[model samples]
Target: MKKTQYSATRVDIISGHLTEVVDDLRLVDVADYIAFIRCELFGNIADIVNSATELTFYPDTLTFGLGGEYTLDWNTAPKVMLDLEFKNMGVNAYFRLTLGADSTEIDLHHVRFAETGRSPADNTALLAAAFENARLPQLTASENLG
Candidate 1:
C-alpha cells in the first residue's frame, strides 16, 4: 500500500493602498501604517494525534486449565501521526509593505505545547508575546525604511 502525504495551502494578505506614494512624505511617516499592515499577517497549524489499542490474541498454557492459563496479547499498539496544516492569511500584506524596503524579517519559530485542558485565553498571552518578539525588529526597522 502507498502512504499518503498532505500539503498545506498558502494564504496571502492583500496590500491594497500601501503601494501608493503620497506627496511630500517620508518613509518614517508611514511606519505605523507599515507596522499595522504587516501586523495583519497570521498563520495557524492544527496538529492532531490519533491512537488505538486492541487485544487480538489469547493463548492457553501448561499445567493450569485452558481458561485459567490463557493470556491476552495486544495486536494493535498506540500510534501517533502528526498532521499539520499551514495558513498564510496575511503574508502578502506584510511582504508587500516591507519588500524592497530596509525592513528585517520577523522570526516566528516555536513549538507551543498546550496543556491537556487549557483555555484559549490561557494560550493567548504566550502567542501575543511570541508575535511581539517576532515583530519587534521589523517595527524598529520600519522607522528607517528608505
Candidate 2:
C-alpha cells in the first residue's frame, strides 16, 4: 500500500454556500486515526489493507455538533477518531472516506436524503460503519505509514 495525504484547501471558509463543508486536514487526521483504531481492532496494517473493507460509524457515534461543546486541548480533550466523531460531522463519508488500498475504491453513490428518498443526511456515516465501531480500516505499507 501507498501512503496518502489530503488537504481541505478546496473548501472556502469565506464563501458560505448552500452546500456542505469539508475540512481536508481533518479528513487526513480522521483517516490516520481510523487506521490506529483498525490496527488495534484487527491486528496489523496488512490485515486491514488485505481485508479491503470500508468502515462506517454507528448513528450514535455520529455525534458531532449535535449536542456538545468542544475543547481543543490535545492533552485534555476527548481522544477518539477525532475528525470522524467530531470535526466533520455534517460531511458525507464518500467525500471524506477512501479505500484502504489505492488499488481499491468506494463504489456506492453518496448523496443526501432528499424528499426524493435518496439518502439520509448522514448517509456516508451509515454507509461506512463496518462493525459497531466507526473505526477506519487501513494501514499503508509505506515506510512512513504502517
Candidate 3:
C-alpha cells in the first residue's frame, strides 16, 4: 500500500481542522498551523515573525480553552519558544517543531496519527495542548503559575 505525502497547504491545514498529523507536516505547515491556532485563539495572526524555515509568535497570552487546565501569562516570560527545523533524512526531508528550552521534538514524519485520523476540532485541541505543553514548564518555574 502506498502512503500519500500530502503537501502542506492552507486547505490541508483547514481540512485537518488544525489537528495536523505532527509527523506529516512540512516547514511551512508548521508556520501555517501556528498561525491558524493563534488566529483561532487570539482572533488574528498579526506581528507573527515568519520566514522560509522558521516562525516566531509573541502573543500577549497563551490561553487554553474553557476545559484547558493550563495558561501561560506573558507578563513574566513573554516569549513562548517554538522552533521549526527543516532537515534532510536521507530518504526524504523532515520538518521538526522543537518547543522550549528542552527542545521537545514533535516529529511530523510519523504515520501513526495520519493512519487513525482526528476531527478538525480535535486537531485544534491537540495544537492547543501542544502550545500549552511547550510553555507550561517555563511559566511554572518563572511565575509559579501553570
Candidate 4:
C-alpha cells in the first residue's frame, strides 16, 4: 500500500458547568468531551488526506473513540485532555496533552494523536506543533475541536 502524509489543526471551545452535589460526597465524571474532539480531528485529517491523496476514509473501515479516567481535587490544578488522531494505511494513532507532572500551573496541554501506515515521519514535527498550539482551559477542555 502507498503511504500518504497528512496533518491538521483543531480547536474546541468548552464551557464550564457542573451540577451541585452533597457537600462531602465524592464523585467522578467521565466526560466524552475529549473523545468528541478526537473524532473531529480525525475527520479533518481524513478529509485532507482524501483531497491530497484521493484516499477516502470509509466510515465502515474506520473507528474512533476515547476512554480515560481523571481525578479532581479541591486544590489540585484543573485538568484538560487534549486528544488527537491520525490514520494511514491500516494504522490509527492517538496522543494526549495534560498538565505535566512538573508543570507549576495549569496551562494548555498539547495532545498529538496520529494514525500509522502512512509516511508518519513526513509531517510529524508540523503535526506536533499544531496540537501544541491548540491548548484550552481546563474548564472548557471538552469543547468540540473546530
The true-structure Cα RMSD of candidate 2 reads 18.2
Per-residue CA lDDT of model 4 for 53-72, tens digit only, reads 22222332222224322334
Top lDDT model: 4
For each candidate, the alpha-carbon lDDT, in order, equals 0.21, 0.28, 0.30, 0.31
Top candidate (TM-score): 4
User: Candidate 3 residues 1-146, lDDT tens each?
Assistant: 13333424312332232223222233233345444555554222222322211221123222111110111365532223232321111111123333332223333432122323676455434444434333312243657653
TM-score for each of the candidates: 0.19, 0.19, 0.21, 0.25
What pairs collide in candidate 2?
8-24, 55-128, 56-128, 56-129, 56-130, 113-119
Query: Backbone clash tally for model 2?
Result: 6
User: Would you list the rank order by TM-score, best first?
Assistant: 4, 3, 1, 2
Model 1 bad stretches (over 4 Å): 1-116, 138-146
> Compared to the true structure, candidate 3 yields what TM-score?
0.21
Question: Where does candidate 4 have its weakest 10-residue lDDT segment?
Answer: 16-25
The alpha-carbon deviation from the true structure for residue 40 of candidate 4, after best TM-score superposition, in angstroms, is 20
Model 3 lDDT-worst window of ten: 62-71
**Residue 119 in candidate 3 has what lDDT?**
60
